[model samples]
Target: MTARTLPGMTTISYPPKPSPGDRIAVISAGAGLPGLLPRPFELGLERLRKEYDLVPVEYPATRKMGSTPQERAADIHAAFADPDIKAVIASIGGDDQITVLPFLDRELIRANPKPFFGMSDNTNLLAFLRNTGIVGYHGATVMCELGRPGAMHPQTADSLRAALFTSGAYELKPAERWNDINRDWADPATFEAEPETRPAAGWTWVNADRVVEGRSWGGCLEILGWLLMADREIPRDLAEFDGGVLLLETSEEMPSANEVFWTLRNMGERALLQRFSALLMGRAKTWSFERPNGPEEAARYAADQREAVLRAMRMYAPTTPIVFDVDFGHTDPQLVIPYGGLVRVDGPDRRITVTY
Candidate 1:
């Protein structure tokens, strides 16, 4: 579908580059796990300073684990209002960023529009920024991407570097090797090197006969469900998403396949499922703090999640193209996606390219 076909889904744009000396604010809009575990947080900060050549700044609530929603909102406003800060990154995703949404000052954020990066629970802020006509990022939380054990995932590093410093179309490739297994960060040894990853199962595509391109919308499925239930930033008119691409991923919470189906079924009822021409499903994250699945169990979990997605698409968007096992969301080596940015899904070529 051409861009003209989609109304209310404008292709948002931003400055092409952030200079080396630029200052980027790091805030914990949701969880301040940086307070509890400094391993990844410190490492992430170092990368921002040493590798990216950008100074990393933190807000008052950034490292406070139990900070209130109002405090988090205050930090967000402070980060955006500061003209010296070129971009904002979340320290990590938390469970209640939605609660902080009501306290956000839309006018302030709009006045000082800058790049904001995050994912998972950060979906709340991403949706908020989208409504404000600002294109926010959907991946690269400091604790997850920057503080990744050992070294940054190469694909993730390259994707983020391009997103932060360049303005153009960047192609996304499935990870050659991916890890769904969890490593305990509490153990000091986990920080010495990267976690183990198995061979990639590659991307699974459906209805691969045509090309579809549009502005991307959607985030962690569970977070999207919350937004739906709360009737938050999602456009009231389902047609607003027509011709757009719907990108979704599940978090570490490991919601069951039944849960995934039920969430999509509700979206179908809202008449929101068919608005998109294609769906990009990030690989399911099967391992978490509560349950660490073995390789066999992890494979089953990913398969079940895919089956659930197929079931939903069959009922709601039967002809839409689908590419599964994308490297985004709660998995290791997450790729940054631009919320409301241009994304092209080339089914025939078996490729996906995102313009950030």
Candidate 2:
């Protein structure tokens, strides 16, 4: 493992990528949504084999709804220790992954570092991996982006392909159109058709006068807040984050504008906001079952959240460069971002690239 340090932070290692023929472990480290809704999960497995050419191995508790934290941790241990399993991925994200952290054998994982791919509630494990000096991926789960209603978005598939097998700089482009609403996974008809999407307005830039390149950190804001509250994997020395790029996104819970502001405010209060040189904010997910917002309302919600972010940045890290509406969070056609790996945000060129 190779280590790179950013100011006060300890060094983080980027684990080697797996070959095409390597085996990948798909575990339900969070919620076992796979058991309740099997169509998307099974489709994702098929894609991993035929589309990506990687054999996916599942654990005992991968689809168990009421799995204990220790059970989940055991699966993680098994996946990491086995030499044949070259990588690990989460089946889906859920609410209680924080409980599994304490049960993890950190030394065991660190000794045999392998790439881990996940997001949302899986943020818990990603953060844990980061602190262990191993980089993890922050997007592309089995039952979500990979198993979309119609098929994997071309952009998402391309991004996942590069992140999975290649080791080089890959430029990221905004999808000409994007989807935020998804069909009911339980309904078989959902798999027969594609989700609806609207045209994209492209990315919005702030402080676009220069370029900033650094290792990536941060994940789902709500989950990060939970980690901070529980005093989990966050570094005690604030300067560790200096000169790093921050990756911030929200989940499907659709937090209000005020909630977004306060979360940033809390990070600012801890002096965490000023550490990063740039921020990559994922496009806000505006629609959900409980909050079935119309187009106008969804637009307003996104606008409000953007304003909230700007407000927080101005109050704290006034000069930090920020790129908004990166297609990597809860939205459809998501891009996979490397956690604790290198990212180049070229403001003058209006481009973003990640090293796989």
Candidate 3:
């Protein structure tokens, strides 16, 4: 999100960018899957060094599964405190990152702000950083985007590169093709080729008559629900999000349409849903290991999720502009969204641009 100039409010600033030769911390803010599955993590590290020309540094808890909150917090502290560490990227996302929130020293992180990159359950840390007045990236993790089977999706790589090394308005485009089906990471053959993909359906827009520009705020819907439940990170005064853009996406766990509706309905009940100038809903990830539906089933799932979101917004923020199936979730060619960054939604032109 862009820096808010409102009186008596803290300005959320973009952290300094990292140079190609800079040292970037590869920490596990969530699960230390790197420890369990080394190939993809190693591949990702090689890319950081060879392709991106950045040095990857790992901390103690970065590879220790079941790491305690205090341990993970310590790694976070060390990464930011070290002047040599120019940026921090999560290894992957996991379920229990919220437990680590209490152990974080917000002031320490704020004092040494670094661009933190991650999504999924790492939404906990992203929201934490925003409250601390540092803009965290809402996409790109070591194992997911960085360690994709074959090569990075050119779009994902370009978006991430811009986010890492530049500061300017970057236009977000719809992917020509996208994939949600995943192969077992444990299988050695999975890395042999890129996953199959389907032709992308362009984003669907609602209220396409206006242009809305504002600082952005929001993350994975499930994690957001958890934050609301724990009552953490969110401002005591909900007005902080007034006129901001809201970015939301679901994860591979694939919550039902009812679950999505109820969570957003609860936000509406809190008087929080109507605050945004626009909503960017990431494409629903319909296929999962547990529920690998074919084309027909997947289509139905996506349609249901979209309807649920529309139903909630119709009740709470009927006039708000919403664009659904924006390809930036647990799908291939995931675009990087700046968490707490400036976004310009030109609905009349059907274009989206975010400040990197």
Candidate 4:
């Protein structure tokens, strides 16, 4: 573990990164949707072996849909405690991840830290690892990004590979094309073609006049709200967030504009928003199986979500720089962001880079 310091963060330890041939743990620490929908999960494992040259080790509970928190927590402990496992990755994200928090052996995890990759509901574990002194990755799960239909997006593949094998400063680039709409993973046919995507414009900037560099924090906006309400692993000292770059994105659940506004509003009320030097709001996922929005409605939905974010920022962090539509959330072609790791947001040069 390399102990480092940023403006707002105390000493954060970045766990040693993995090499190409190292063994990686693929555990469904939150949900075992893999048992029900193995198409994507199996494809992801194949890619890990063939494309990435990493072997995946699964726990007994990895494919058990209704495993208890204790069972999942045991898998986590085992993954970290194993000397042969160079890294740990989640099979996918799920809503009940927050419930698994209490069962984690923080000391065991901290003592044997290895790069842990995940996002969405895995945000809970990411936040926990951050607090426990080990930096956790904020993107890339097996079934979602690696197991992407047809093939992994080149942009996403590049980001995940770097975050996994290399450790250095990596500059983030906007996706040439991107997608948030997903097909049913349950249907094997969905694996036959890549999801359709539209050309992506550059990220939107608000108050883009200066460059800000700091440690990154926050993830999966809805999961964050759950963590906050449950008073899970949030630091008692709000100062821990001061001068950090805030990272926030919603899930496929697609919370309404009003819900997004209220969540951020509540964070602002807690005096949290004002602590960040800059914010990276990920591209809002506009379509889901249930919503199946038309293009017009999808455009409106993204716009409204943007407005909702700006509304809360205006109230609590009026002048803070913000770059919207970063491709690092539930969106396809997602980029990996380091949790509790250094981020340099260059507004003047219109660049965003992360320390992988």
Over the stretch 107-172, how does candidate 2's per-residue lDDT look in tens digits? 899899999999999999998888888989989999998888788999999999999998889999
The parts of candidate 1 lying over 4 Å away from their true place are: 1-11
Candidate 4: tens digits of C-alpha lDDT, residues 7-27: 344478789988889999999
Q: How do all models score by TM-score?
A: 0.96, 0.97, 0.97, 0.97
The 0-to-1 C-alpha lDDT of every candidate, in the order given, reads 0.87, 0.91, 0.91, 0.91
Please give the lDDT score at residue 248 for candidate 1. 95
Give the Å error, residue 331, model 2.
Answer: 0.3
Q: Give the CA lDDT, 0 to 100, for residue 129 in model 2.
A: 88
lDDT winner, 1 or 2: 2
- Scored by Cα lDDT, where does model 1 land? 0.87
Model 1, span 1-356: residue lDDT tens? 00011126433566335678899999999998999988889999999999899999999999998999999999999999988999999998989999888888877887888999999999999888877778888899888889888899998999999889888799998888888666776788988878888888789999999999988889999999998888888765566688889989998899999999999999998888888989999989989879888878988988999999999989988999999989987887788888988899999999999887
Name the better of 1 and 3 by lDDT.
3
lDDT of 3 by residue, 226-332 (tens): 98988877777788889999999999999999999999999999998999999999999999999999999999999999999999999999999999988788888
Clashing pairs in 3: 1-340, 1-341
Residue 153 error, candidate 2, Å: 0.2
Model 2 gets an lDDT of: 0.91
Residue 94's lDDT in candidate 3:
95
lDDT score for residue 239 of model 2? 73
